[model samples]
Target: MRRRGIDALTHRAVAEEAALPPQTVRAHLPTREDLWCAALQYTLTGWVRRGEEFIDRLPEPLTLEQAARAIVEVATVHPAEHADTTRATIAGVYERYIQSGRHPELRPLIGRYNVELTGLVARVLARHGRHVQPEIARAVLAVVDGTVVYRLAEGETPIPAAIRALEVAIPLLCPFPNDT
Candidate 1:
């Protein structure tokens, strides 16, 4: 699924990729939609896990800049480690974004993802003994997402742009001082 889009997903192809029997793949996936759902969930789950791990590894009493950097890294660096993986992850993300618009069932999942992201930003703010309005947090997320989408589309590194924007906005959004 990471290597190809939903249309290319099939029990036989999955079995071939997994080096398992087609019957076993069918018994597990049952249908193309089921397979696609599982594959998408699997990718998201892995990404979330890595993100949690990255947050867990942060030093105690995180500074505002550190917290902001963490969020940026989780949103970008941790999801895509290599060129191919980066392309695949971007493809999956845009595909889901398009699918959510066309499929109402996915809107709830997308909403939940947004809520979780908001909570993450809130937690990061709290850890630094700072507070940002929900609107500001949402704006920060929008900046991050927009930067990432731009990077994926243009095949350019937009980290400097994102960091510069965050450096400028975070202090204004919260009471914390920019140590960097």
Candidate 2:
């Protein structure tokens, strides 16, 4: 569902994209809700993986500025490559995130995502030698989510706006800075 919202996802479409028989796809997904959950799970898992991978690539004991910038840029779109695909994925995730209120089946997935994301934010802060409460980590997530939605609503590239907003907002969100 990277190129379209979850509403557009179908077993046939997925089968075609994956070059598998439609029956195989249906056997795995079974229903629209199943497909929706699977698609969302895939996207959400990728997002978490992206953050973990970014962190893995960093040198040990990151500087505050490095960790701050890494947290801002890690999960957002990479501007120079696969820009459209990244934008679509980001939009699709937000769309799924909002759908959790209407679709009870999706609430578990969203909850898991939020927990993982909260940990990611916290990890970035810890890497910079500043440990924060879970609420503060979630606030970091809130800033990025709000900025992304605003940019998307304005028909602009969300990544740049997210970067700009996070750079300003993250320091303020952290409880305190470690002088290391």
Candidate 3:
């Protein structure tokens, strides 16, 4: 159902595809929105799980560049598995988040993860370059997210492109001593 994209799915269609009775499918997913949300949430959970695993594998006190590179790499590698649905769902979620004033419960989860990532970046900036600022960390994150979205939309998983972009942007954001 997911591989074919959201348009290909209906309650009856999904039930048939799953070889389950329509009523049984309806019991689990009462509406098209429910099905899509479930699929998206499932995809998101997998992403979160992968991120946790990657964090666990990291050496203590990962530098900003290392953390950024790790995140880009993981996002690049995993999203290629379900690029279509995942991208669509991400677009949907971002739109919903922007359009509605209410925050989703998942917002905190995302914020916490981002805080950890940006904090690492800020630490690296403080240690290796000039003063670190919250805005600098945020700009770095925006670049990474934009790059990931672009690569996913192009049906390409170019880790090198992401890495290079981050490497270039990092200095601009932090302005290392040699950058001058």
Candidate 4:
């Protein structure tokens, strides 16, 4: 349901997709909203896990550009593992969660996950020390996200372009003080 969108998914559809009885699906999920939320949470957990794993496998003290390149490479190489559409959907749901009066229970979980993602980016930027500020770190992330979205939409390869762009832009955006 989360992959396809809520408007197009029904309990029966999910049951059929899972090769299970509707009753069984109801027994586990109970409500369409619940199912959607669970699917989103599952996807979010997977994304975070995959990102952390990629970071872990890399050598320590990665430069800002290297960290950014590593992340984009990992994501592009494993599109199935980190679907761009799913990330966009999660972002939408997160926005809705903030506006909705109900579902206070979900806010903490979503907020924490968002913070985790931001902290990962911040850590990468920290390697550049005085060169990169919090705002610049955020802008870098936005650029990376936009690049990924464009690549996905166009069905074009982005790993090389993303790496090159970031490599060139990072130094300009956060130039060494002495060089200035």
Candidate 5:
């Protein structure tokens, strides 16, 4: 589902990708929705785990600037070096996010992701002494999501350059001046 869009996700395709028999895939997944929902859950759970690891690695007595950059970096960079795969995952998630509008059944699953992401950003901001607000967290997420979408749309912006740009832009857009 990451490399290809939803339309391309069929039992045979999934089985081929997994190097498993079609019968095995069908026995496990049962239906298309079951497979897609499971895939979404797996991808999102991985993302949340990575975000937590990034936060754990932040420096003690983290300055506002460092916190801001670290948070943006998590949003922008793929830590396991699977940048392309990560990009594909993001694209897949974005598709599901859009599909949820029409399908509705995907709402709770995708909505949990939105809530988790907002909470992750909010915790980072608060760690750096910012007064945590839901609006601020949502705004930060919006900027990150928009930046990522632009990167995907253009297919040109180098991830490193985009990461640097986001690090610089975050403080300007949502300043958290260092009191240290």
Candidate 6:
């Protein structure tokens, strides 16, 4: 679904891509929606996994900007060595994330991921020195995700503009640091 959208995810196409038989694809996916759901889950899982890995490497006492940077960066980025291949993968992931909106059943999955991600953000910030309420963490996510979508629409990478936006939003969202 990276080169195209979910519309292009046919059993035959997947079979061809996987070098497997069409019947095998059908047996696994069962329904077209199941195929789409699996594809969406894979994309979302990659995104979430990258974030988790990145945050684990960070130092404690993380600032809001650092948290925001980590959140936005991990969503669409790979380390310097992996950038070329991962760029398309990340784009596919982001596209699938937006495309999930077309299926109403997928929204709860999206919401659950968002809540888990937001909780991670809040926990990471609080675990270190920086602390923000869950509401603020969710707003921080909105800023990062919105900036990513905007940059993607403009054929730009999301990191730079997203960080610039967070520089602005972080202060607006948290005027004073909340005590741990």
List TM-score per model, in order.
Answer: 0.76, 0.81, 0.58, 0.65, 0.74, 0.80
What tens-digit string does per-residue lDDT give for candidate 3 at 25-92? 88988877677656555655565566556555666555656655665544432333354445554444
lDDT of each: 0.67, 0.75, 0.59, 0.59, 0.69, 0.71
What is candidate 2's lDDT per residue for 1-180, written digit by digit as tens?
A: 767766678999999999999999999889989998998898788888888877777776877556656665554623323444566556766777777787899899989988987888788778877788989888887887888788788877777566667667766777454522
lDDT, candidate 6, equals: 0.71
Residue 121 of model 1, lDDT score: 71
Q: List the residue pairs that clash in candidate 3.
A: none
Candidate number with greatest TM-score: 2
Model 1 stretches with alpha carbons more than 4 Å out: 77-95, 102-105, 132-135, 176-180
lDDT (Cα, 0-100) at 9 in candidate 4: 57
Please give, for residues 54-97, the per-residue lDDT of candidate 6 as tens digits: 77887777766675566665545454334334445556656656
lDDT (tens digit, per residue) of candidate 1 on 17-128: 9999999999987877677767766666666666677677778688756776766756553422243445545446556666667656456666766676676776666666
TM-score-based ranking:
2, 6, 1, 5, 4, 3
Clashes of each: 0, 0, 0, 0, 0, 1
Where does candidate 5 stray beyond 4 Å? 77-96, 99-103, 155-180
How high is the lDDT of residue 148 in model 3? 61
RMSD of each: 3.9, 3.1, 6.5, 5.7, 3.9, 3.2
Residue 58, model 6: lDDT of 79
Query: What local lDDT does model 5 show for residue 98?
Result: 76
How do the residues 1-180 of candidate 5 rate in per-residue lDDT, one tens digit apiece? Answer: 667765567899989988999999999999887877777787778778888888888776667556656666566435524445566655555676776676555677778987887788877777766655777777776766677678888874434444555566656666656632
lDDT of prediction 2: 0.75
* lDDT by residue (tens digit), candidate 4, 1-180: 445554455779888998999999889889877765666577557767766766666666677667667645433334333444444543443343443235554555566665666555556555444346566766665666667566646666545556666777666666668868
Native-referenced Cα lDDT, model 1: 0.67
